[model samples]
Target: MSALARNRVGQYEVASDLSFGDLSAAVAAGWRDFRAAPLYGLFFAAIFAAAGIGLSYYFYNRGELAWLIAAAAGFPLLAPFAAAGLYEVSRRRLSGDSIGWGPVLGAVKAGDGQLPVMGVIAFVIFAFWVILAHTVFGVFLGQSGLGATPLQTLLTPAGLGMLGVGSAIGGIVALFLFAITVVSLPMLIDREVDFITAIIVSVRVVQLNTFLMLSWAVIIALLAFAAMAPAFVGLLVVLPLLGHATFHLYRRAVR
Candidate 1:
């Protein structure tokens, strides 16, 4: 394959060959980045964890804990935004620049208005996911589970069908979101490009490395869910680790 172009249009060349070794290295580098800037990682991770905890608390108190399944599935949809700061930290570390709160936070503004645009896109997708999830829940469980415990509700035949259908839909939605933003968010942080161009490049990267990138998406989802199982504390470590790792992955996947 020809080398990726570094042209004038702010487009990046996608790497044609990305192996599992590259993924491991990116994760290792992410760990190093986190170690190098534990405070920054911890700070961002704390905010993410707090939000998860807050949502869980809010629903659990209202006797609607079951709805958390949908929220949890959709929650990571917003991760690219939470990762905005972590990407900044990794970028600065790689460039040998000073790592400070001001500069790291300021990196969100580095995209020249594209970051917020991406943020809006992410929020809209999340909103859609939530609404769809609610509809699915209603269609399957409806008032049948009104007085039942969350666990009891999920044990019903209707609940099982809903789970099956909902998982299939959520998986497709998450994969689509992943392909578009996987490289785009970091690309925006690294360069100055409109959201449209960045998304195109990102989707191209995933298309070129479909199996490998899908494996990456699975790893991220699994790790994130496992982290959330521990009262959101694991996110203090997992989110930063994954966030930093993603930036490094973007570095390897894009030129």
Candidate 2:
């Protein structure tokens, strides 16, 4: 079926023989496009960053410390669609369209209906991730609750163990989710395909070049972690960078 396919939606992307070199080229192209139209990227990223700020402020006031990890990790999961506008920027740049907020945002609004379906998938995964994270903490560190500050939990042996265990489990979930969305969002925008097909192709592409894709995942994780260091301000830059990069990366991953 893959061999007989015309559109690179489900099955496998027969046109692609992706490699690590593609990842490198994608990042470079992503940076070039971002520099060309920084405003588009900034506009979309700012919306997400502001939401981050709002959530942080709300949680801080309410003293919902346990929600912190989920909030931090979940934003990245939400990035695929949140950065739809940025992806549209990359699409416009590739097609030589004049970049304007009206047109770019309109393009995003006009994207595939399947985009929202993908969002539902992300929401489920995020909810599961948060629940699992809470469970890990509860099982390992509940006896001697981490207090005053969340960082204080790391001081104990059980706390350290819980962190280690939780991180590993979270990493697995993150990778699986990444595989399903890595190329799917851009593909959904670029083609007339359903979300399920896009997701299958996305997973197949990752399987075809597992090591390269895994490296891309690691790079995304590191950039995201570093970006959070500046109190979520860094996401303003990191989100768009990765968003635009993922578009170009998808191009290389499929026909």
Candidate 3:
């Protein structure tokens, strides 16, 4: 099949004759495309970080654990915005458009209308995971007739064992969830794909490139840690670079 006739799904070029070498080339192309717009990326990152800090401060000042709860609850509400910049980067790169703040904002704004729907979907998914996690914890740890408080029971060997098991289970579940969703939102935005398809594709990508994706995940976590440590000021730089890099990665995986 001609390259022009290739079916594009998210970033993947769906042609039967495509080779791993071609895929690698696509990934390299994506990285090169992303690097072309470093300043634009920095600008988006500044906006995202500022908004995140403002929201975080608002939650902290309220002192209503409910606000923190709600903020956690509303995390998916903000997922679309996070995906917006990445989508903008990918779209522009694919179209061979010059990157700039104006076009990026325009593209994101055009797509902003979908955020609510995506947010709702994200909220439901997040809620389900939270419920499942808590249920698992309660079943495995709470049922252990250790004591009144899990912490108090931790003074004993059995309690420690239970705690370790619970922690390990929780960690595994969290990692699984992260792997499923890491590329999903951006894929949705970049390709105008539905949420479910995007998520499934993302999960497939993670399954296909587990070690590489895990390395990327670790890098993201470390960058996030550094950004959050300094009153989140570092996020202005880190968030955008990561956002752009994520788009680059998404492009690499699909095509």
The estimated TM-scores of all candidates read 0.93, 0.90, 0.60
Clashing pairs in 1: none
Instruction: Put the candidates in TM-score order, highest first.
Output: 1, 2, 3
> Which candidate do you rate higher for TM-score, 2 or 3?
2
* 29-63: candidate 2 lDDT, tens digit per residue: 88898898888778777887788778777866886
State the displacement of the C-alpha of residue 253, model 1, in Å, after optimal TM-score superposition.
Answer: 1.1
- Which candidate do you rate higher for lDDT, 2 or 3? 2
What tens digits encode model 1's per-residue C-alpha lDDT throughout 134-194?
7898888776753546677677788788889899999989999998899899888988788
lDDT of 1: 0.85
* Candidate 3 residue-wise lDDT at 251: 63
Question: Which candidate do you rate higher for TM-score, 1 or 2?
Answer: 1
For model 2, state the Cα shift of residue 113 in Å. Answer: 1.2
Deviation (Å) of 158 in candidate 1: 1.0
Quote model 1's TM-score. 0.93
Lowest summed-lDDT stretch of 10 residues in model 1? 1-10
Question: Model 2: runs farther than 4 Å from truth?
Answer: 1-16, 109-112, 149-152
Span of 10 residues, lowest total lDDT, candidate 2: 6-15
